[model samples]
Target: MTKLGLEAKDLEPTRTIFHSIVSGFSCSPIGRIRLDLFGDSSHFRREPIWFEVVDLSSAYHALLDRPALAKFMAVPHYAYLKIKLPGPKGLITVTDDYRKSIESARDGAKLAESLVVAEERRQLDRIVALAQEASTAPIPAEDPADKTSFKPSKETKKVKLNPEDPSCSKYVVMGSRLDNK
Candidate 1:
């Protein structure tokens, strides 16, 4: 539209919705426009094309769908990366440039990488926020009354293993308290 010196207001209002496999949800078109598309000097088509205006950055200006292809009666050869359409002189063939296709693929990869980085950054921010909240919270105080010292519940007798050494004495539980196996 900018290349043609036309604005969005110039397009006829439409309620038509468009969807793509890349984007799962349906998009409402900004408007509909009838433009003359030329494959070559001999082959030209005037067709109504729907446009969905978005603020996202993209490598391609517009994506032609089945409706546009049907309007021009074009047959696309995926293996050859070319489209063949009927013309007054002969069959008009439109081929994609290899360099442009490579550049577009590179741009698409960069876009996907940037989106992943942005999501990771958001998750990091959330984790940082949670850490900050936890740090600012008050720590609970310990109760002094709950503290206790360890004590033995059973009575024991001291017996010297070596009679020559009094320091080698070992403590044994009372025989009456012991359970018989």
Candidate 2:
């Protein structure tokens, strides 16, 4: 239809500041609300022709299944969707493409996560390999200090630990706690 020849009523979203535009829909109790990103700061010049009246509960599902949520953060954020209204000459469509920003953020986040995960895995693998190598390799020989080479002073070793410390009765304990109270 020649809506251009007719009056052109701008619209704005009452709920969100999305770039969505609607036409030929029923009015609400508050009146028609068309959320236009191109709309002025006052939002007074705009009026709603119709409402999507969506519960929006299914928006997530729709975004995931239809819009391929994996592709981008198509979670019905503000400043999305496009509007093609009846202008004086032709259809005046206003589109705010937020896809680039959304994609940029998403791609950066994914890359960062992947790099972190890969680095964590690499560290874990190195630790595991070191543990395995330690298990397989033979222990280093303790170089015996010749007691004969040292001269005994007037103060002899008189502490005389009989059976040595109780902890020395067995090998060293690893991790958490030890039953040896």
Q: Specify the highest-TM-score model's number.
A: 1
TM-score of each predicted structure versus truth: 0.54, 0.27
TM-score of 2: 0.27
Residue 105 displacement in candidate 2 (angstroms): 0.8
Clashing pairs in 2: 11-34, 12-34, 12-35, 13-34, 13-35, 25-50, 32-48
Which digits, one per residue and each the tens of the lDDT, describe model 2 over residues 1-181?
A: 0222322243333543223212212223222233322233433223322333322111121121223322222233335555344433444444444665566557656655665687689999999999999999999876566653554444433232334675544443233333335
| Candidate 2 C-alpha error for residue 167, in Å | 34
lDDT of 1 by residue, 3-66 (tens): 7677888778777766542333345666766667646545655455555554334445556689
Candidate 1 wrong stretches, greater than 4 Å: 1-34, 53-61, 138-181
Off-target runs (Cα >4 Å) in candidate 2 are 1-96, 147-181
